[model samples]
Target: MQPDDLVLLTGRDHQRVTVAAQEVGLLPGTRARVEGRVLDVTDTDAVVGLADDLSTRYGGADVVISNAVARLLPEESQAERADEFIDVSNTATHTILRAFGPVLRPGGRLLVVASSLGTLGHLDPRLHHLFDGASLDQVEYAVESWRGAIHHRTAQEAGWPVWLNVPSKVAQVAAVRAVAAERRAHDLAASTLIASVCPGMVDTATSRPWFSDYSQAQTPAQAAEAVLDLVFTEHVDPALYGELVRFGKALDWHDGTPPGEQDTMVTP
Candidate 1:
């Protein structure tokens, strides 16, 4: 692993990750070269450029972390923008994989920050659509495609490890669990590690202020530390590569657990 690794942060989540990296003496432009390239993960230009840049610089990345969320609500809540949560998540994830697939070095790491909402249902009644009439089989198929694309792209060149972290509600865990099971059954090339880190109610600037009312709400720093612990650890599994890591309650990555238990595999 390169001492000076290249880190890419897309969208608002970058702010939190940036602070965490800085605390670890890995700030961009200081410890590692940090590039604030603002591009819509769903945009073709941005995705393509990301791939090109990653391939060119560092030959491939030691780690690629994505915290990009799809546009859920409309610019004007009253305006008519499609509330297609599935489409946004699938498209953004697919675009990132397709574009940057070729640039992840073998054994290199890719961490995708997904909400637990993707797995567990009923956390928010409004998101019931994710589970309504939803089949785990179909969800598995989508996840396989994602893992396959990344694996096939880097196979001959330099295969890398792909990890996914889906931390949200019960609904999110269900989604991640189904996907991990499917990946294992299919036996995809590149390893797909999945974990769910349920942070309960995260009191971030982006989240509703009312979230603070929750006694269990966690700070952004706390969450970021949990994520970092998972990303840096070894003992990754290929069979159960995908695991859902819950964050709140008693479970946490930063609290010093067993070696492998601390790492939550994910797909990004």
Candidate 2:
């Protein structure tokens, strides 16, 4: 948190967001102005409205970090919440990019705080096409197809595993790639970065419930160091712009497994 920076934190829970701001305010000698707003990121209109309001007030923002996510309980997978999952995980990125990307200031950063599982490798190769394309409609169709397949018990046939999170995570990274491609096609200021970051397995409510062996999970502050490194760097590597990064390095786009899953990384 920079002394000159005015941070805007949003979440669905008003009290939670307020408390977070107050906590930031308490950081020693920090003069950062933190404001909390009630935002349900899954809502398209509301997200765009916030972006418009911000544009009017701030002209544009220097950074936009997407930390929104939604996951059903492990028991709910068979019950099938694929559509809701995609809405929260996949389409939410589209909405974020559309609203925030344009107004990102020169040399600004746009980061999606995704999971390490959010890689093309997470999904079977047959399903890779869902995320490889840049078209927004492609993303929409893929989400529609997966939800339909899950509803019909054809997800496996459709090249998706019973666990829906892998695909959702992959799609989230793909959304970052799509926006990155768009960013590259146009002229922009130096050091402008657009990428999705995986904070690894953090010991948080969102992740704690999903892992059977939580021994390797990093604390929230620990996981945040890698992510904050990207945000604060003076010049981000160009190679990392469109990629899904873990621990300040880009992950192999086509690899079947991300390194974090293959072995635990030593905490720095």
Candidate 3:
């Protein structure tokens, strides 16, 4: 973030939010205005309220980033707590898209911070078309189908990945695609850019527990470089729109996951 930028940080915990604000000012020469709001991102009403507050107070946001997520992997049965992924993580992402998509200023960007395990190739091949929706509603239906499969205790049999995290993230990447198409249809694509990014296995306190081996993982600083590159670039290539970008290039939707990345279970 630049020194002139005003940043708003939100999370459920007050102390963590305050500390995050403090951390943003740690660098001596970096002096961006940082504010914190205690919020439950999973709540649609609260998220929209925040977006409205931004619009009324600051005219609108130049950039919107949705990074809220639930457990990367749980040792217990996915069937037991499948709602956490959908209701918490997936809902938070879609809510950001719904509320903020309309309020983003011209030339603004919307970036979804997802995971490298977010590709569709891990799921059964036949189900791929179900996720390639041009509209948000249709894309979301793919996630709902997985929810139905899990509720029926037939997710595996239905060709859905056993871990809820994978499908949830697939929905995230797919939503970016949906947003890109919507912008293009609305004639906003010429002014705005939208993309999803997979910061490959960053070794952060929050993420280390998700993997058994973290030796090869990049530090949080390493991961931020690629993300900031997109955020700081004055204009991105039109080809990057609605695509899942890794490093600096876009990945095909059918691309597989990184080796042993997600709970050490997702195949490479």
Candidate 4:
């Protein structure tokens, strides 16, 4: 179908992303028209208000892509940044799903942007420490619950398709830096999550800067197209929900052991 698709952008104000999208003809009335910007995905009241507005205006949407991320800090500064990240990134995601879930149509798609940081460690030493006491099983369980609740409420039928785009560490870092370089903090956390859930970096308004790196990256428009393809062509089974879709290439760690290799047994 022609890109007359209705897309809701949560936190995209950076010039690079906007310019790239426009250059690639993804702007409204082009490939896809972005109907709204949540402005403040971190604010519960704002998120609810935006959701209500979208429901009233469009009634529902074919796709809802959330690209938000939390602020990063040094390990010594993590104790303070942790709560902030959770509130802005994790908690805000839950809030958006809760608010918009009921309005989404059946068979419609919901894409949650997550980071490879949420999956593989070792890429960033800071993340290794951040996830020190974390449990992937528990984290995955929570994500499933959130997805289930949102999909259940949004779709007309019992099953609503939800997918996650989880990109690797380099891609995630590049995405964050893209926005940070532009000083766009509104949806930084959300954007990070969006980059995370997708299979690879997208070539859209948000990802152009990363592509400029040449050494490691994909275009945001490419990423956007991939996301659309996944929503329309992929057969998503709710039972198979919560899969982390990586972007670009997977990270290669020479010295570090691969995931699931660490011994779970506690040392005496």
Give the TM-scores of the predictions, in the order they appear: 0.55, 0.89, 0.89, 0.51
**lDDT (10s digit) by residue, model 3, range 1-268:** 6676788888999999999888876757777888888989878899999999989988888888777766544466667778876887677788898999888887787889887667777556767787766478887777787888899888777777766667777788888888778686442444676889887877766566556787788987898788888877776677677788888888878887422234444211
State in Å the error of residue 131, model 2.
Answer: 2.3
lDDT of all predictions: 0.45, 0.76, 0.76, 0.43
Query: Model 4 over residues 1-268: C-alpha lDDT tens digits?
Result: 3565555444545554555445545534466654434266768888888778777887865566766755442222333333454455555666655665566555555566654433433222432332233233333343344344443454213221122211123223333222223322322322212222543544344344323444445555555665565466444432223333543332322123223322221100
Q: In candidate 1, which residue ranges exceed 4 Å CA deviation?
A: 1-3, 12-30, 70-88, 120-199, 209-212, 238-240, 248-268
TM-score, structure 1 vs. true:
0.55
Model 3 lDDT vs. the true structure? 0.76
- List model 2 lDDT by residue over 1-268, tens digit each: 5666789889989899999989978888878888899998889999999889878988988888898766456455432566777777777888998899888877788899876677677677778877786465677678778878888888777677766667776777777887787677342346788889988778777666556787888998998898889888987687788888999899887766533323321111
Looking at candidate 3, the ten consecutive residues that score lowest on lDDT are 259-268
Per-residue lDDT tens digits for candidate 1, residues 1-268, read: 3456655555535666566545545534465545454566657676788788777865765555555543322122211222233334555554554455456565444455565434432222332344334445444353444345444564112211122222122323445444445444332354323444444456655454223254566777777776666566564545324444544222322222111323332212
Error of 4 at 96 (Å): 1.4
Candidate 1 local lDDT, residue 123: 24
Clashes of 2: 0
